[model samples]
Target: MPISSLARSITGAGRRFPPPLARDPHAGCAKPDRNLPPDRTASVIHKPHILVVFGTRPEAIKMAPVVAALRARDGLDVSVAVTAQHRQLLDQVLAIFGIVPDVDLDLMQAGQSLDTLAARILTQFGATLDARRPDRILVHGDTLTSMVATLAAYFRQIPVGHVEAGLRSGNIYSPWPEEANRKVTGVIADLHFAPTPQAAAALRAENVPGAAIHVTGNTVIDALLAMRDRIAAQPALAAGLDPLAARFAGRRIVAVTSHRRENFGDGMAQVAAAIARIADRPDVGVIFPVHPNPAVRPVMEAALGSHPNVALIDPLDYPHFVRLMAMSVVMLTDSGGVQEEAPSLGKPVLVMRDTTERPEGVAAGTSQLVGTDPDTIVNRMFALLDDDAAYAAMAQAHNPYGDGQAAQRIARIVDDAHRR
Candidate 1:
């Protein structure tokens, strides 16, 4: 199918899935299916049902690897349920993987508040669980969708395996609701998929049972690696991007992306200003893919739009984004996924956020947290540009996350969880 048609097909198919439960008929009855076939039969067959829930683009990116891993297993039935918190972006990831979600909540709305999102997730989730009632729920990272889904599962005592768990900024308000969401989910989660030793340590410090925690590296790196393979298979896509990729050919391209709700007005303005300053440099060019969010578009267009060197285009697909990351000299953005991805590519990242849950990257010297202050962002960008040795040191630092087998490891853990 054509890319445009695929997008339409997925969106049209997605609407048919039911939303989170509005009424709970089976919330109390949702329980694990604890049945073992005869010893000989069980050895050959006894597929465990694992329900994976994610909504945003980041979540989708991070979870795709896990979904692939689970599907590849000998005895596991994997079903993906996307809440469609990010709409188009979410669908793009799903379409790329060619894995249609078994259930899509289609929860996005214009001018929707977080409260409405939470309530809708709760209502709809209650109903979904009552209907499907999988053996285990696998939720990735922290988002309102994950938060609500984890809570709903917890209420029924459903086992939740939290991928990329134990990430912490400590300060609850720094990452805004996310810090709280992850911590709370940590309390309710049965298995914690910690991406780094630091993350595992945090979970340990929290007194979460060591038996429940597994150091499975960040699944995003696995997805990035997989995406690179996919991109190589379709070299035609690389044709249109070659010239632009060549413009960033030998030289570094600073792959930039910023669009967090906390950084909408003033924070976005500061991010734009930082890009403008970077664009002024004769040698270094900024490649910022503008997000579709209206709040982000105007500010980005107003600041970095018409710049001679800065290439502001539409948001890239997962594969394009990875190729760009591999070509980048340094990454500048507030995105959490970038923090994890850049380190694996040996690229140094300058985070625009004031706080990050992925402090493992910073501790590993792979990333620098330069808050939304334009001056701080500019100065750091220049420092990295001017000092090659400093740039190399940061870029070459070992990624603390994982060795990129996170998806496989998570699949094994989920299988083990089901047997018990």
Candidate 2:
């Protein structure tokens, strides 16, 4: 569906879909005696309202599939709310997925600190909860936005369902605030949609009741598969990468993404140094979608801006990014989504972190952990670039993240819970 049409369908403006069919509350029960009394004859049916909330690009991307699934089902009224923490980046995913958020907090501001953003999301979303009065609120993963949004819902005693829950890195500060944010959400979230057996096990270890945890696959794979198919049919959707592909036609391309807070000053510089070493090769070229954060963009540009074989460009949109992944020889990123996504495309991911919450990929042989050490990164890059056997071993391994039906499972679970 087009963005406008989807928005209209969500808001009941144009009504592209047919009205929901009336459901009988007592479908399987025996018919009541209408002649004796009318009170027993009539049945009351109530549709539970669910509010889905997210903020930032990753949250938006992961939640897009869930929104589509929930909206397509009957007996549930689903509404989307975006905190817009990463304003421009969040909107890009929203457009690609054709999701029209029923309530947009528009909370992003110049140089907004963490505490300020949290305060705004809590205050504004508290008001939203009061006005919308949804029966439950669904939150995704661990962003400051997710944690704060979950808190807002908790304040009102509204039940919250957490998607991609039960990720733990042991040390909360290593992945910075994310590890802590997810753990906090795990405490308040009544319905835990864990992506892997490992994640479910982690939740159980924490004493989160086993009944609340559902082992649905990660939704990123669902989004990735859907977009991959879309691009396959409509090649023009990702045509923006033609020039970059042409520039490095004869050489193998390495797609890179890094913007972790742990890898800020020294870590980011070393990463640029590693890329510089790899780009020095005559047979290799690097395509890095430099993040726009002041802490990151300039550091990378200073180290690699003038390199002939390096294309340090702005972030590509969804389809274009998918195209980058499809054509690239190896995936290099610190992104949690990339770890799950690259393996689906048969791309070996060299995770740029010492520890990862998604350890299934490492144990499954789809990826390897090569932290921010310049020497280690260079060695790993060269190993994959020079040897086919090493590359194939990682590429051929199974992607344990998902099979592309997570959103459907999540929608069904939510619908069933609401029916109760």
Candidate 3:
């Protein structure tokens, strides 16, 4: 399908999807009703007051569509709260969407531990909940902010709407805290906004109430489309990217993004080696957006640092990343977001982790989950690099996660639920 055609189809379908429920945030927590079937329902008497909360860059990207949807409803009062967990990067996403937070906790500190980040979000979110007194809190994806914000909402008896909910790796430790975060959020969220059928199935197997779950697709595609539109509209950005686009016009561009805890030490070294090897080839140029984490920095710098073909730069803002993905030959990453994003761009992805929660991508034949071993990373990199048939097969596979417009669908669901 033509890129514009596919984008329009996804967005159009998304805007028409109906949401299952609209929850009131101030409603006190009720123990799961064991006697009622998941399909059991009650009529809504009022439009919900929603407070959307997030801290990291990914959460902001995904939540922007949901926030926009909530704001369109005349009766629903919407507010955005940022914990500022990642500080600068989080603000970048907010600014891109032109969203100003009603509350900014500013919890970021240099080199803060995961524990510290979670604790700070919990404490500040509790204070925000008490003061704002919104009827519902919306938290996106699986992050420290997602978990702590949900917990704080639960503690305050505020209902939670979990956007991009019900993702599971089966093994909690594979994605470290994230797999566990989504699992815990499931237990507390009154409204579950699942992005895919696979995610909905996972929630059902775990016995989460089906009445509470809505398959809203993903919001990242909405963010990407929004960014793409912005880039196309801005002559300066479009002009700036032209030279870079022209430089690698015909040669394949490999986009690499690695910043995972499991892949930090030896794994990062392996990825770096693979990047250096890929860079050595005249046909391949790597655009690596380096994450700011200290653990990932040295390994990335030491190995791929001096390579002429690899462009090692600071972590890119959303627009640049989207543009890069759109133009890439293939993607190599440990990030959960990229796994979903690449296929929308028709770019094959090699996941650097040992396992993935997004089996939809793999099942669709767009992604390969290669572990962090040096040999495996190098082998797969070359599989797509050297083998024309393999590269074409992976690149042309259908995207299971989305075509785009995930955000628009999510917004429609929230808006319709409110209307009902």
- lDDT against the true structure, each candidate: 0.79, 0.85, 0.76
Between prediction 1 and prediction 3, which has the larger TM-score? Answer: 1
- The 10-residue segment with the lowest total lDDT in model 3: 4-13
Off by over 4 Å in 1: 1-46, 246-251
**Between the candidate structures 1 and 2, which one is better when assessed by lDDT?**
2
Q: Considering every candidate listed, which one attains the maximal TM-score?
A: 2
Error of 2 at 66 (Å): 0.5
Candidate 3 ranges with C-alpha deviation above 4 Å: 1-47, 238-250, 415-420
Residue-level lDDT of model 2, residues 11-52, one tens digit each, is: 100011122233343332223445745553443224567789
Candidates 2 and 3 compared by TM-score, better number: 2
Q: Model 3, residue 187: displacement in angstroms?
A: 0.6
Better of 1 and 3 by lDDT: 1
Q: Per-residue lDDT for 73-188 in model 3, tens only?
A: 55566778898888877766776678988888999899889998888888888887777666667888888888999888777777777888888888989898889888888888
Q: What is the lDDT of residue 166 in candidate 3?
A: 81
TM-score for each candidate, following the candidate numbering = 0.88, 0.90, 0.86
Could you tell me which 10 consecutive residues in candidate 1 have the lowest summed lDDT?
7-16
Clashes of each: 7, 0, 4
